[model samples]
Target: MARIAFILLCHKNPDAIIRQAEQLTAAGDCIAVHFDASADAADYNAILNGLQDNPNVTFAKKRVKCGWGEWSLVQATLNAVEAAVEAFPHASHFYMVSGDCMPIKSAGFAHQFLDAHDCDFIESYDFFDSNWIKTGFREERLIYRHFFNERTQKRRFYWGLALQQRLGLRRKIPEDLQIMIGSQWWCLRRRTIEALLDFVQERRDVMRFFQRTWIPDETFFQTLVRHLVPGREIECRTLTFLMFTDYGMPVTFYNDHYDLLLGQDALFARKISVEASQLHERLGGLYASDQMEFEISNEGRTLFQFLTGRGRVGRRFAQRFWEQETTLGRNRELMIIACKKWHVAKRLVAGIRDHTNVPAVEYLFNEEDAALPDLGGIETTLEKRSRHRRALMRMIFDHFESDRLIICLDPSSLDLMSDFFADRATVRLLEISCSFDDDYLAGHARRVGLAGPQTGADTMARLLPTIRHDMVYERDMMRDADFPNMTRISDTGSVDANAHAIAQFLGVSLETGKTLAETPHLFVD
Candidate 1:
């Protein structure tokens, strides 16, 4: 059992921190809380109380004040790391997380991943060329004074103190200094942590130099580690999925994005807010298991089995095929539907399944050509179409139940389908259109007395209107004509030819068409 420790730096949101601690505990991982002294101790105690006799949790003694762009935040983190090392000396790895950070994977899997890599997971991107630091400096100088100074009710001197450091007025650092950014949240091997600590301790001059520098959080550890262990076994990637707002503040993850986060293969995510309580609740299940399932089948099989049992076996099978196609490149038990021609869908599915690594193709026949002979005894015609469409949709949805979905459709189709099923499930939508230059289709509707050409004058015009007006008839006709060709309706040409065009338009790789398979519903309505 490789031991892992979660070091969380918390402020006022003790409730969130406590919830995170509980999640870590459920994963059989140890938690260490480092409360900034500036925050209320009573609140910290309340947080500790929530943990309630959890043997895996420990409250750190040292308290440090942290300010953005100040060295204190990094200092506080280093202090906590040192304390965690001493307390959980046998821990295989130490993960530095914020109160806002949440684990996306089980601690067991995290431990195994670290054990295998023997490398630290810290997203180290070249920030030197990025406008981030420069922009931060400008915002502090101008925006900080314009907005925050008045809101915080701070004196002129205090505001100046805050802004001066952020604006780089307090430090004479070089303009061309190589800036590197890793996630403030990271998982480090014990050896990496010790080496960092050693470097900080021995190089007191370097530490002192950085202490007075601007944006130390972005610079301190990155500069030191790059120098200490140049080209060492440090992953330039962080195991955290973090979303940033336009203002650069971290935003809470939406519940709908849960599947995306899971598919990203990252270990943790950061900046979860109080509003994301529902998201936290959902993720709790992923990390709740005592032992992490590393094998792909172990993770996928359970979900697949459940979906298959729900009378969604066909869709589940498709999804399984997509996964296999993406991972193994062997297409065995898969199906393809070409809107253009039956023979094309059939031959492509058959050829891929038989010759390539793809699974057997279960060609979905159009209602007109080969009505579902299986449902011959069905009574009502309307009921039959509904049932058939539902069955077809179910198969598509099921295939994507455990994998990422990449929907390929025109803007009109995307608008219709997304609006129709907005509340049904949590799936990511990526809208694509083959042509951006031509407004011929837009003008054709106007000529047919359906609607005028879409103009940028109104925001509503920019987006496809959800309301089904008479204009939608023209749009529908256009869609029907285009969708079939797009899906390789012809048997004479290759499915790969048209499929490749669609995939290219969507900016995705044509690897077993897994993205298309996973994304079941294409809007043509």
Candidate 2:
């Protein structure tokens, strides 16, 4: 069995840190903690007192005051690693993680996997060749010297870089060194750690060069590991599961993320919220197990889909950057069901979802209305809600990347309805006028606060003919002069029958198992 030593770097939440230490130490693994020097003294002392009885837990001799994108973070990590190495010489592997990290699997599983594979698990990508750095200065991170804290003093930091750029002041990277960067967390073999320490002791100039570079913790060890170990022995990936936003901020895990995290292939997960006491309590049971191998139920497919890129935003809404009509083309197959009745419209959305693979959305407009709730506290401009509805539609169309998008519109979305009808080449417009049924018309009028059922019927009869529609669904036969294309649909028909009529018009097929109407909360009114 491979013995593992954990290096935990922390700044706050002493109680949670203590809980983590207890769990790891109980698993027959040793841990070394480095508390940030700037943190409260009470927090540090509390951690010490809590773990004082455990022989497996130790603390760094000195704490370094850490900051985001600064050299201090790397220094604190070094202190913790050194402490772990000195305290646990029998440890065959060293895993560096944050204090917020928790194991998803038993410690035995991690040890067994490490023992089975002799390769080092760390994400190392060539700095210039890869697009890992998304938000900030990419190439400049290596050439230009960064002195200011980028997060705290944003203006001065940029100003400093700008001044350097103007002066043509650039530092030459250490010769013969292939620069690499990746996630800060890593699990390295004992031999790799020894080799890395030896290189650091001999290369003070290289150390000084990285000291002034941006976010050195993410680059320092990652760059050095390439030269220290053989390429075949490196796995080029981390064992810890970490997620970040487009802005490069870590996404904190919560209590409800148990399934998402546990199903992942990763042995450990990081950036957990301190207040996630229930998650902490649940994960506390995963320790000191004799079971060596466990099956990963999800294998991380669903988790990554949710955490990466534009997909991070849920289906109902998308990022503001993606709220554009850039992908709209003549090849698009989109259908707009301009229906106002909540009861009938919901079943239609559900039926379409159950029978067809096409993505169907209910109340694509009027999200702010009672049927569908708005994104909490998302303030919008004073412009008409139609503009907002159009933007959301464009985002969904772009993000979904499907052959067809079936949308249900609200009573108030006339402007949106008109906009889609004008685009005859791309959109297939379907109008469900008040002729569907007397009950439906009455319900729609009452729900929308119209004057009367006849008033609602008259409004649709007068306005719908002016708009171009490929098809109209009605319960009673309409005058051929008004509806050139008509499909008689019984309001009393089965949901499947209504779904089949819709599928037939779109040249698609329907299945019966899963439906969108089941998730009524996701649909906006």
Candidate 3:
């Protein structure tokens, strides 16, 4: 499948944004989105919650303070473009669209359309002839100083205009660059975008001049397309259809406009309102998913349509980022349970993740472990009981599920095996033991970023296994640690030998499963 990177700029209505993202996305396709800096916290979190299922979607880490009809809009769009480029290395074609935009055709059709074309699809026309800025008035865009804070900046605009009218104080457009204007949207090839990004980086003087220009985004990419990549294929038409009024603002599409939109040969349609339920239903009915997404369509359309009307956001199902990210389901191959022995537990979890990366959870049983719930000042016995042990079990059951080897570090956790076995959290619960060298001290562990203030007896690692473990790893003094794991691993071949023992205990060969093959990487500093 061809990789396409989608950069979507959104301010409100995360439901519509989520719908648009899901429809445009498939395997190997990535979506990069930038929410307006002033966007509501709940709405922003809703967007993240909605897209949590899609690993391909990435948000800009640095948000741009967007201002409408000013340079900040372009800045936010540029940030989204840069983020997409950084995140999706496989993406070759880049599509920049708006949050209100929706795919009118199948994803395959859009993919095939881009695959058939070799050049970028950015449309532009000479600003002098387009009449978008009234021919002779086109120069007003470059000469005027448009302030980003639109409300209070109105007086500044008028004052600047008066100053220019009286004293010719307006800024001059660069002599080397020609201004162009068109539909402020495009689908471009990767090389063209990278070149454009590099051009902006090299020519900040041009950006500084344009930052004060009226609606710079209107002229920014359009001018660059003409100046930087001349003689390239220009479509001169946007993929999104928008009907405009005499005043030059886009008219809202209603149910009546659905037929017209369906007949048009475009990939997307913009500014659809949720109040027009029939329109959304018709659109979803036409472009549904492969697995018969009528239900998804109905749910998404219902929520989107309702939200579009009042701008109230809702997801039928939602969870916090970590909760949604690490939720477990059985019918898998391996499950990791890391309790109090955080040192060995951390390493073993890393080893399993490196080998298979199957579903796993690293539960810290030690009250000393930072992951454990806080036990701050409980006066009553019930309160004390609820704070430490009860909360941990509740958390464990909530995140627990697996079909493979369960590596539990704390023996106290093994006492709750009946709780897990009842839920079938795993097909089989394996007892694993960890033993560190006697020479190892708590101070040594502290130097390596582990928790401090211990007498270094370290009986927990050796004693936990004897109670219930079926396999024990006699981890010799640490030496060969993975760079990601951040421990110096031994070069004396003890790790390989320990891996061999693990394989032997499991009744599997070192050559049979990737588990042993991947063991060294966990400690291969």
| Candidate 1 least-lDDT 10 residues | 327-336
Error of 2 at 450 (Å): 43
Backbone steric clashes in candidate 2, count = 4
Q: What TM-score does model 3 achieve against the real structure?
A: 0.52
Model 1 Cα lDDT, one tens digit per residue, 1-525: 567888888888787777778878776778778888788879878987888688788877677876665567787888778778887878878887887677777766776777788767776666555554535343232222222222234485367666766776644333433446655767777777788888778877666666655556766666555555556777776677675554666656666545545544577876556686678887776787655643221122222232233321222112222222222112211122322222323443443443334222232222333323334334125344333433443444444442222222222222223222322333222222222222433343343322323322232243224222323442344344342212322223344664565344333467544344333323221
Q: What is the TM-score of candidate 2?
A: 0.63
Task: Provide backbone clash counts, one per model.
Answer: 18, 4, 12
Quantify all predictions' global Cα lDDT against the true fold. 0.52, 0.69, 0.58
* TM-score of each model, paired residue for residue: 0.52, 0.63, 0.52
Predicted model with the maximum TM-score: 2
When summed lDDT is taken over every stretch of 10 residues in candidate 2, the lowest stretch is 468-477
Candidate 1 TM-score, C-alpha based:
0.52
- Per lDDT, what order, best first? 2, 3, 1
Error of 2 at 53 (Å): 3.2
Instruction: Give lDDT tens digits, candidate 2, residues 1-525.
Output: 888899898888898889898888787888999999999999999999999999999999989899988999988888888888889999899998787888888887887788899989989999988988776678788899998998999899999999999999989999979999998889999899888888889999998998998989888999999988999999998999887655667778899777557656788998778888888877778666665554454324332432252211222223233234433456666776655455566666666665667787776455444233243323132233344554445556666767578777653444454455444326654544433344444444344433222333444343233221211312111222232222323344455654555554556544432132233432332
Please give, for residues 379-403, the per-residue lDDT of candidate 3 as tens digits. Answer: 1243343234333334444454333
Worst 10 residues of 3 by lDDT: 476-485
Name the runs in model 2 displaced over 4 angstroms: 246-248, 291-293, 299-525
